[model samples]
Target: MSDFSRLRHCMVDAIARRGVKNARVLEAMRVVPRERFVSEAMAEFAYQDAPLPINEDQTISQPYIVAAMIEAAEVKATDIVLEVGAGSGYAAAVISRIAERVYSIERHETLARAAIKRLEDLEYGNAKIIIGDGTRGLSEHAPFDAIIVAAGAPVIPEALKEQLAIGGRLVIPVGDDQRQRLCKVIRRDATSYEMIELEAVMFVPLIGEHGWAEDGSRAASNHKVGASKKQSLPAMIAEAAENLPDFEDPGFGALFDRFADRRVILLGEASHGTAEFYRARAAITRHLVTRHGFTIIAVEADWPDAAAIDRFIRHRPSDQQQEPPFQRFPSWMWRNVEIRALTEWLHKHNSRIEEMEGRAGFYGLDIYNMSGSIGAVLDYLDRVDPEAARIARERYGCLTPWQKNPATYGRAALSRGYAECEKAVIEQCQMLLRQKLNYAGKDSDAFLDAVQNARLIASAERYYRIMYYGGSESWNLRDTHMFETLQHLLEAKGSHAKAIVWAHNSHIGDARFTDMGAARDELNIGQYCRQSFGDDAALIGFGTHSGTVAAADDWDGDMQVMRVNPSRSDSYERLFHDCGKVRFLLDLSPGKREPLRRLLSRPRLERFIGVIYRPQTELQSHYIQAILADQFDAYVWFDETQAVTPLGPEHHRGMPETYPFGE
Candidate 1:
């Protein structure tokens, strides 16, 4: 078979695995000649699952995403479909095979003209391409059975909804320009519409009278203001402020009581090493465990390392044998004063609870410890069943040479120099799971840990292998593992068990409202929790306008006290700083305040600092456009903050080496 034909089959198979169950959609994908849609120079890459640049700086949508959006619209054989942002006419061709007729609108005249000829050449008789602003629905072709918009919009255009027939589905991305949620609006009646957010998507800005402006510079220019005429900070403070001096304040308990019934409470940090963010999370977590009966504290740390902290907190005998946790890169993240205080509090709290009644536990939700997990699985088996341990050792022996650096093994596996040990790892995990009931009668916790470790080995192997290949798939795998780990912990703890998740805002905030999701097709624990538990999950985000943060200039570099840059004039942090409140909580639940709600919906820059910080590229590296009110359920803002104090002796005492001030 030809290479393109083979690639076509592979693409269809991959989409099917991603949960596109429509046979008709699958068939259409198989039959479509994607090579015909692109220029001859790019024809070889047509079958790849990524968006390729086409005429007029536009791109063809990724194959899986196109199928997903089409499936979301639920087009029928007799229905007429309207597709906005029909770049290269590829998506319209796919839809035409599923629907009776497809009317596609493209904002770029050059792209529209090219797409028209390509569609005609490919004999897509039912598909029509027109040049116009896609944000304005084709009113001449009124009452479309399904309207699928391919660009991000500030809000769902009323004109598009008006064009949808009764009981019709309109699949569009709704949010700010940088990031948006794939929202499916079903016309329930003449005046009522039901909106369901599917996943996060990033697309070019839809420019028109009803959408963003044509030049794409309006958002920045409109929000920017001179110092004397800046929006009133005091007015916003007075309208929305709820003072939070400390986590122990009575107000915090009352605030937390509002989410007393939630199964998961995800706390987010704007930066990983902000002292206030860590303290705030610790305080809230203490209340959740002591008063609200939350049973687990799962963090963004790796599993094996966090298991050590978990043992220490639970006062398990295994703690004596385990090495200190958080010894890896970014060790200060969990091995700091803030986390130490929380772990001590957890130990004290667990002391008062009965073992069976369920003492609160600490766990990790990252997949960076492939070799450590493998060792952990073997260690557990040796203690319980030496015979089984021997078998596991032999099975995992193939990976022994690369134990110090598992990524080397991943590279070897991907290059086909060494075979993948996926089957062996799976079999080991299955063996542990199959004997769960037998082991539960003796040492249930040990058995559970061993099974989880075995599973982590399998997942981490796949994760590292994919990471080497370079794409967004590895990120999805890691987050999926974390979400699954959270689920398992919840199940093991009991149905009533609640969890407090600690992670960066990027991972804890709903990705649909953040640029990370739009650009990388990433999903985090927060999105998974929201999807699974709905309103039963509460996500709280923390931010500061300017602060001292503990971070390294490069990965694995020495930790230092880094100066955080001030929020941009048009950023969300500046808005909060303008409020003139030193520290306050803003509730962002639906139906809170109409004026504040409207203000928060407008896109503004938000800061995100990971373990590594480079001041020179701060704007490009750290800032993302987001609608504040949509990103979190409640936001805790500290106008000025300080760096977290590290626990070890390697901490640096001077200002960061590359401070930008006076440069």
Candidate 2:
């Protein structure tokens, strides 16, 4: 295949994985020659999953957006479609490949003429262009089977709604210029219609009688609530955000000194597999551990898995395992080179400390290892008391059948009513708590570890039993467990204990300020920590505009090194990108950047790349509406970043293959 053809086919495949399952839409997008629609200078980026600037100060909507809109419109092969804002004529061409007749309208006469010339040259005879106000739509074409608008509107236009044929779909972005929602309006009858918000989007304002006035809509919609009129968002960020030196620089460590006094410091990552996030967080943690006496490094990982690493780092004895920790799918999230280096450094730091409780410690706050946690609890009880071990086994055995695939238990429990073991696990945890004094007298650390394992079992049991039905409440359970685990560790370590939490932005940022809380009613660890600890907790979030990330397409899928799409125009990451700084830190505390914080308090998009990333459907799948200033106290930005270096089994811990247990 030719280079363009190969790229086009790859783009189609990527979009398929991104959740666009419409065969007609995929084929239409695949057949269209997007490279010919834009200027020669922009040809290379034609197939990229991003909008490229075109003539008349307009943009060609990204390939995925066009396909998604077309799919949303449900354009049939015999359908007559209308496209508004035919910038570069790309969307019209794609629609023409599927629809029988296509009428595209543009306000700019030059763009309309250019689109017509390209359509004729490409022999797309079914597609035609006309000069008109797109927001008002093509009235002469009236009653189109489908209508697609490529610009943002303050509200759905009456004319466009009226032009939709019965049972036809009109897909458009409706909101202010800075942000909008891709809405699907289906005309059920002459006077009745159904509206569905598909996803968040950002588009140039549709300029016409039915759209915005001659001037732009941003200033009028946004007023001077934050920064003065003279300073734009990017300029304000550039002035407010602190430009930090490289990770190696001592000054870089000094930049985090302001957080030294905080009891709990949560460091977030833009993605699970970004090397820069890992390296930067590790550097900050190292500085805090060595200079500021921070004792704990808690993370979003399975409890049993993290326990192994914690033992290794703190010079404590651990049960010898057949394989290393984090061997499960997406193992690279914790079993990568950057994390390895951090563990080694923490181990060395702990070795220097004579006070056992004061030494740096590593721990996990997640609850995903029911099997391992069960084994740990049983082994501990067996060593301490045979009778308790037997009782524990009997109680935990109620859940043994579903331990490997706990999701089945949730469904089975619901279908088979009395199958859940909630009472048994709860009793087990209470039993451990009641015997805490008796166990502590023997070996406090071991007793605490065993009790925590039991607590995790109880939480995991509930997590699996309710996960299938709990929806957002289950997510709440997980985060609540993590927050409680952090509290447990702090309580166990004594009053002077300090902690540094390492997790993704979704877990570390205050969820109340994001769609997670506002739309779904989910609370995360950061929100809980802030409410419980107040000013003692510092929630820091992270972001990256573009580059690459090591992620999987689905849960338990093999990892792939995928290119990160450029941040959406409405995201804080994009605003940071426009600041022209490769990396910086924005401190939005009480006095640092009052104007910047106020500007950021307004809702905007924020990307959350977990172990999975879908670039094609990114806006729908990953980006969440967030008030950045309220979500986090400090924001770290990297304009571009590279994927983490995942370690092979032989290279575990950068040690020799002979050392299966690792360096």
Write candidate 2's Cα lDDT for 1-663 as tens digits. Answer: 898997888777766765788999999888888899988766776776656667665778767788889999999999999999988888999889999999999999999999999999999999999898887777777889999999888888888999999999999999863357899999999999999999876676777877776644433243323235358879889988788789888778789999999999999998999999998999899899988999989999887888787787788876674246787877989989898888878778888888789888888899887887888888889989889999999999899998887778878887787567888988988998999888888888878888888889888888877775533658889999999999999999999999999999999999887767654457999999999999999999988999999999999999999999998786788889998989998898977667667777756778999999988767656776678888999998889999998887467544534322363
Alpha-carbon deviation at 92 in model 1, angstroms? 20
Task: Point to the candidate with the largest lDDT.
Answer: 2
Query: What does candidate 1's lDDT look like per residue over 404-515, in tens digits?
Result: 7888888888787687888888888889898888777677777767878887888887886777654458878988999999999888878888999999998888876765
Error of 1 at 140 (Å): 22
lDDT of 2 at 524: 98
Q: Rate the local accuracy (lDDT) of all candidates.
A: 0.81, 0.84
